[model samples]
Target chain A: MSLHDCRKAFSETLVALAEADPRIVAVANDSIGSSNLKEFKKRFPERMVNVGIAEQNMVGVGAGLANGGLIPFVCGASCFLTGRALEQVKVDCGYSRSNVKLCGMSSGVAYGELGPTHHSIEDLAWTRAIANLTVVVPADPAETSSALRAAAAYEGPVFLRLSRMPVPDIHPADYRFEFGRAPWLRRGSDVTLIANGTMVARALEAAALLEADGIKAAVVNMSSVRPLDREAILEAAVAGPILTVEEHTVVGGLGGAVAEVVVQSHPARMRLLGFPGEFAPTGSPEFLFEHFGLNPEGIRRAAAQLVEESARVAHETHPVR
Target chain B: MPPDSVPTDAAAESVSAAKMARRIRRSALQMVHAARLGHPGGDLSAADILAALYTAVLRIDPRNPRMPDRDRFILSKGHCSAALYSTLAEAGYFPREWLREYMKPLSLLNGHPDRNKVAGVEANTGPLGHGLPIGAGAAKAAKITGASWRTFVLTGDGELQEGSNWEAAMAAAQFGLDNLTVIVDRNRLQQGDETERTVGLEPLAERWRAFGWAAREVDGHDLEVLIRTLRAVPFEPGKPSCVIARTHKGRGVSFMEDRVEWHHRVPTAEELSQALKELGGGDE
Candidate 1:
């Protein structure tokens, strides 16, 4: 499979959408080169609003642009776009119901050397909590195009957390995206691995490893965090145990969403995996993933352990059905 | 601030003020009763000024809410939604009877002003400190388009504590948005307590002057003064305008006037009767 960064895919998809719809406008906070929006700005200068270094104004301006009958895709580094303008996003876009697309580039430690301040680990939790906002984390290039297309088609505010990390394309080029639904990658009876963003790739590797160890692991890519895929989660609960992983804090991220679903639906055995609610010490993105036990080998071990635990629980619940 | 000029008694001024104030109070009560659950106290507090604006000063069209040449009004402190809804209804943007479905699950009359949901609402603002920047942007839009559609925003006194407002203030002055007008509802009490105890803006007028705005102070309940001052917008050329309106928390309702507890408190049957009588809201 070809390798692609979701940020490049986002830029290309946005340009294509703009070509088709004149109402589509791109707004950046002095991040033309950083958000990969140089070509877009050059092509449509009138539609590009480059508000320099002012993230708060950038978000409010995006809302203003939307109010004026234009659909705005507000692009910037995830850390500043979600952190600096968080209140603006809540009030101007969410509360106001402005038709704005918040494109957060390089989320989840993608800026490897930029340290914790520049990393956007809390974006998922932050955007997910706001009412009337749809939070999306695209796993790879194909998912990125799908997410962008969905965001453009939807008539509401959306947050698209794009990654700068290069990843092998997991979904086929013809992947059709459905917002707020999980994409099932495999079918298994022992356990299910639900993930999004960069963690989906490692989840796939883990599933393969689990199969090698004579354990079948189901892999589900849960891209939308808000209107979660309750149906798929219920199916997984009925099938076997469920394990959730993400590139964010385990406390209130994807794992938390899965736990919420299981507690209400089938009440299956579950294991939540991610960064253990703490900032990672300085390291490369690859090093950090390994340190947090998010690599494929670690995920594989976690999946096996969950399967064994689920088997034990199933035996205790119904000795002989 | 025109050289600290004295108040003038222009012909037809007092009569116009009395008429506008009466209409605003009547409209505010009708909207709240229609919606069933809305912030009525703040609506009453800000009614006189909004009445002065729509009836006397602001240039707008009820039929064409999005006219390119029309002036813009942003209610920054949007929790007082009843006031805005009534103003727009009276302005003929929509049927006044539509206020019946306010706060209903499917109704567009949400708890806050949503520009997308409501006609004639320039910006959607429920949170404090969001209006000034948007109003600044609208003013900038006018400047860029070479249109003289002046932009006006009304904010709560307590809402100024948010740093975003100061940022917008600084930016507006920097851009010399002469088409921008900011009106502060200095109602003293916020959701909890008096703004002086919570966060004082005693030197408020000077603060605006320092920020390159032409500043003025007026009795918010005085419709005559509000109308007179609002009519003379952009008091100084090449500068934004800031009008500090001194108002009571609940201006017309005798028992509720200046009472901090009535911020969003639901009125009982007895209290509602007393308020209606105090407001002189009869069968019109």
Candidate 2:
């Protein structure tokens, strides 16, 4: 399978957008190479602002640019951009409601060898907790391109987490992105596997494995985590037990979001799969995913266990049926 | 907008600015005293600079606070919102009666200045080191679109320790943001102690210059000097401007001036009366 980096899609979409709209500007904290904005800078030098490794100032400058009638895409490595400048993101971008697109490049455990300091596993929790901010994690290059356009069209703060690690394209070239809706990738009646970002492709693989074992499974691509697709989650709940997977911590990423919806509207048996609450050790991105049980085989095993648990509970509740 | 084109009646303008400063100081005192839970020291210290900008320096319209071309002013040291509110009210951005609702539950006048709630506020800022970067962004935007409007940001001396300000300072110079100006309310004292004692910020003017800004020092309480210095912005062409205004933490009040404890100290009834008498007591 040919692999694609989502950050490339993000940068290409941003440059294409900038070509059409003069209001589009790219602001970074000296991460031009990491953010893949060198082409953008070369095309529009004046519109590119490189603030030299200052994450907090980068976010604030993005807000100020938005206030000055320009749409600024604040691009940086996700760890520093979201962690170091969390307060600024909360106040300047989130609370102030600035039209700033925070492009968190290399999110999740993409920088695996760089250790926990460079990992942006907490970005989803940090950004989603803030009010008036949209959080998105695109599963593929096509989805990344569409999400970038959607973020630009939406006139408010948005956190777009783009992966630097290469992964196979899961969405077609003509995929249309929606802000708060999940696109069902595969349908089944036995169990549903919910995931996003790098884990969405893995979830599809897990569902195929379940199909081989005569246990049909549904797959959902939940990219928009903040304004989660409640209707999809409720629908999945009625189908079977849900197993949420992500390239983030299980405490407050996709799993937490799904659990909140299920507990509030429709209670159902579920299994949350991701990094356990601990600092990830040094390894490659693939190694970290395998170590955390975020690979297809791991997801398949978790889904199988959840299905069996759901069947046991159902039988205990209504034995005659 | 010529640098030296001070109004022909410069002396009259100075006197009026001085009077406006006094009014703002008194209004801030009353607002803080009414709330009994607000920062008064920085409010009193920032009065003269706020008055000068709102009255003479900034190109703003009270009726059209959202004018895209209007000059941008951000209060980075948002704990002193009482002073900003007083100045905005006196400038007719909103009714003077709204000052009374400051810090009240569900009131638009929050403990911090919220741009969404207040018409004249450019940004919601309570966190330090945020305004300068935003100001830099606005200035960069002006440069991008070839807009003539300038951006001004007021930050407390102690607020400069956040490191984000230095980041903005570098970018402001790198972008050659001649339209941007940063004013530091050098009120020596902060919450715990003097700024120098808490974190040494001495030789601050040279620091700004080192960051590629045209740095200047001025007496913050002097209205005439402030208006003149502010009008002569981009003190040097092609560089961002920095005004380090030396000020007493609690100006106009003898007991509160330069006192560390008065940073957020609410005045007693006796102290309020004494302050009013010293400020030439008059109701808004």
lDDT of 1 by residue, B211-261 (tens): 889999999988778877887888999999999999987788887789898
TM-score (C-alpha, index-matched) for candidate 1: 0.82
TM-score winner:
2
Q: B19-113 in candidate 2: lDDT tens per residue?
A: 88998999899999999988999999999999888778888888989988899999999999999999999888999999999999999999999
TM-score of each: 0.82, 0.98
CAPRI level of candidate 2: high
- Model 2 segments more than 4 A misplaced: B1-8, B281-284
Instruction: Report the lDDT of model 1 for residue A116.
Output: 90
What is the alpha-carbon interface RMSD for each candidate? Answer: 2.7, 0.6
Q: Could you tell me which residue pairs clash in candidate 1?
A: none
